[model samples]
Target chain A: MIEWLAARAGWPARWLLALLALIMLAGVVILAASIGEMPIPLSVTLASITNGLGITDLPLDRIQQGIVWQYRMSRALMAASCGAGLALCGTILQALLRNALAEPYVLGISAGASTGAVTVLLLGLGGGLIGMPMGAFLGALAAFALVILLAAGARSSTTRVILAGVAAAQLFNALTAWVVSTSANAEQSRSIMFWLLGSLGGVRWPDVGLAASIVILGGLICLCFARTLDAFAFGEDAAAALGVAVAPVRLILLTVTALITATMVSIVGAVGFVGLVIPHAARFLIGPGHLRLLPASVLIGANFMVLADILSRIIVPQQVLPIGVVTALFGAPAFALILYRARPST
Target chain B: MSLEGHELRWMKHQTPIVDDVTLTVQPHETLGLLGPNGSGKSSLLQLLASLRTPDTGRVRLGDMPLRHQSRRRIARRLALVEQHATTEADLCVEEVVQLGRTPHRGPLRPWQPEDERIIRQVLERVGLAGMRRRRWHTLSGGERQRVQLARAMAQQPEVLLLDEPTNHLDIQHQLDLLALIRRLALTSVIALHDLNLAAMFCDRLIVMHRGQLVAEGTPATVLTPALIHEVYGVTAVVERSPHHGRLQVHYLPDLPPA
Candidate 1:
């Protein structure tokens, strides 16, 4: 349906699609905030949010209002931001690396960030001088640098890059496991394992602020390079021939991806599959033009994550499954579908 | 505008791929580069395009050093259609051609009437006007090459560099493409394999053997039985075709090496 509209209408169709996606995202976010441990009505949730923002005052139960305003709202917003950021990274990586499977989780960025966060938690690296996000950022860079180094000689080969990423993910995951097993007590290990599985239970307003700001900033920077990324459709040499400053643009964009991935990993642990699958879905719906693909991925990813979070909360009897578990459960089958669809015609 | 490469040398893993190659393409001239396999024609074309920095020499665009100009600035005046250039992205033909306009447009600039006009004109010129919306993966090899040519034409470059663009093309397209290049009269350096096509289309010809320029002149002067044997290790009889009034080469079976 969207393809027909976009093809028929051109410029106006993009705006309409974007508007539709934004509305869908808003609806899912509201749905997420309303359906939780304590069921709150949609009207009360809206009133509570508006009241919290000093936009409107309405009578509401204090506990329900507090749950919606303080806990569910922040968690929902953070999920949206995290989803947008991850999907954006996936889109950029797939373009630059020219591989459909390239994403933060698959490329080892998330695993590296998990290692860094675990180091901060158990080993007390930096003596609390550096925060978890900073540590994760450094580790993400380290893993990325390692992958690039290993993949340097075969830089044009996408398969070699993915292999190098597999190597980095194994090495960092081992490091994370070693730290936790060696240093943590039973209770600490349990908590660390839970965090590693991606829990959004503890996210608050501050986390939401950080995630939203980084995602917005990163999305904007990526938008500015949309045309440059398009030039890379053929390859690096092709991009250079088309007047893209390949090296600097690559460095800046990779750094931004690492930063965004690290922030999300540090906050909510390594949520897999969204980054890998959302971009493909967005491309399928909107085509491969980065100008539209980037925004479409962001909005779709936001909605997908919020919906995933909602499912994570409600799927069990009085228990919350990890967000990563829910995402992977859905994303794995979707990934298979994408791969099946992508098979070359005989 | 003239494109000149001065003493260009590029090495990969300590082995020279393009060695001390110096050449020039005059304005409105189609210069054909001929070579056997592994003769460094592709590398030399890249060096001339400034896509790869020469190890020890410089390329000049017009009178200015190519290294001094921004990539965007160079792209506006020069374009390269790389051999076997393709993408995994599911881009339609028109979208792929629009990529040619990158150097001419900016991020904030909306698509203009001129840009659309150029795209349409190039598509029409390349004979893919009706297939604008065709997905790339659905196209045949020959169609893909023509689409790439259309893209290069959309760049509006004064100096065009193409590497074996006729590789996958049919015989008709090969002739048509060369004739089109001739008609455009743009400063072009084309790496071609067919000696007859080079002789028929190019104003001048240069031949490479083992990363060195071994022959350079008009095709009539540069192409000879001795040069062909020495460079390509092939026995051939070179004669002017009466039908086309151009040199045509007839190859003989290889004599057993003694």
Candidate 2:
């Protein structure tokens, strides 16, 4: 039935699907804002949003407006931005490395960011809220540089790049664990543990703004290189034959993806599975064309995170779970299903 | 495109694989390189395609030295199709062909109607229009070879370099692919293993033995049974085929121990 529809509608169906996904994303955003211990009604949320935007003259109470516009909206926007950024990073890494199993977390950028953020948190770099995110960003950049240095020695093959990412991830994970153990403060340890497991809790409007800029800029950069990414699907030599400057292009793309991944990780810890899962889901929906694959992955990723966040809010009333935990709960089963289905065939 | 390899030399791990060899290919001509295994036919092809640099000598396309040309510029003039197809992801046939336009496209440009027209024409030319949307891995070996050919064709290159293009193809596909290439009339440098097929398709044949050109001429003048026995260590009867107006070979089996 899908194939019939695809044939009859031609390429327009792709646009239609994207439109439907955008509508669904808007619904998810609205629904996410409405849920929580202090439930905000849809009408009140819309009014608060308009009032915030200076679109309506309705006189609403400031506390309710603040809760809706400042807190809920910030968290929801962070969720969407993180989702889109991570998914875009995954898509670029998968194409650049030509590996189906690649993701930002799997490649060790997340672990590196975590170790950096944890160091700041444990060492008490600053009392300011921005300390952890800033530290994480720097750490993510360091890890990215190390991976590039390791992978650059062998410019002809992708084996070194994948191995370098693996090594970096493992080393950082161990370092993070060591930092957590040696630290004396109990509160710091608890904060570190929560950060490592990932969360969308305590997000502010500034964090959302930062994440949105990084994600949109990174996604646009990736889209610019979509044709090069397509060439990479045929492997390094074929890509080179097609006139792609393999080494430089790969390095630029790796840096871009790492930067975006680090930005998202800094904002919301290391949200796993969204990067790995959403790309595969998007590929299944729209073939492996990066042009379509990218946008679809973004929409689906945003939807997935919002849904997971909503589930986190509702699953245990009066106590909100970390959004990352909810994603793992849902993503693990889906991953298992894909593995079981793929195992026999392979 | 006119390609000139001036005394090309290549070494692997300090061991010389291709000795000083010079050859020139003019536009609108097909040059076939034939040799035994490890005779550096593939290496020379790679050098010509600029995928690898020659150790000691320079290669030039027209008046521009290959070393001076950017990868994209070289790719605009020359396209290469290697024997092996290694891909980690599943891409559809048309998508693979569309990738050939990488050199012609800028970072921000969308796909134009001209690009689609070229892809369509190349796909039809290779008789792969019916399987345009099929996953690359789902195709048969012959179909994969044709798809690769289609991809190279989509490049709109002035020169095409192929390494063992017919490695996994059936006889019919082998003939069809060569016939299609012949009709394209682009300057092509192909490394072929089968002498009879090379004789039938190539305008000129360069035979290599131990990284050196042993003979260079039309097949009828260069491919005698004596040279074949010396280079290949096989006894074969050579004769002209009635159907194709080209030389054909019939190999004689080795006798039992006596």
Query: Best candidate per DockQ, number?
Result: 1
State every prediction's TM-score relative to the real structure.
0.97, 0.89
Best by TM-score: 1
Q: List-wise, what DockQ does each model earn?
A: 0.63, 0.57
Off-target runs (Cα >4 Å) in candidate 1 are A343-346, B254-258
CA lDDT, candidate 1, residue A204:
91
Q: Tell me how candidate 2 scores on lDDT.
A: 0.83
**Backbone clash total, candidate 1:** 0
Error of 1 at A277 (Å): 1.2
Determine the TM-score of chain B of model 1. Answer: 0.96
- Native contacts matched by each model: 0.76, 0.80
Q: Over all chains combined, what TM-score does candidate 1 have?
A: 0.97
What is candidate 2's lDDT per residue for B1-258, written digit by digit as tens? 799999999999887788888898989999889999999899899888888888889999888899857899998889998887767667789988888888999876988999999999999999898988898778887888888888888889999999999887889988888888899999999899999899899999888888877888888888899989888998998999998789998888787887
Name the regions of candidate 2 deviating beyond 4 angstroms: A1-13, A120-138, A141-168, A337-346, B208-215, B220-245, B249-253, B256-258
The ten-residue window of minimal lDDT in model 1 chain A covers A337-346
What are the per-residue Cα lDDT tens digits for candidate 1 across A1-346? 8777766777777898899999998889889989987888899999998988888888889998889989999999999999999999999998999877788888888899999988987788999999899999988998999888888832458778888888999999999999999999999999889888788989999999999999999999999999999999998998988888888899999999999999999999999899989999888888899998999999999999999999999999689999999999988898778667653421
Task: For model 1, report DockQ.
Answer: 0.63
Shift in Å, residue A297, candidate 2? 1.3
| Highest lDDT scorer | 1
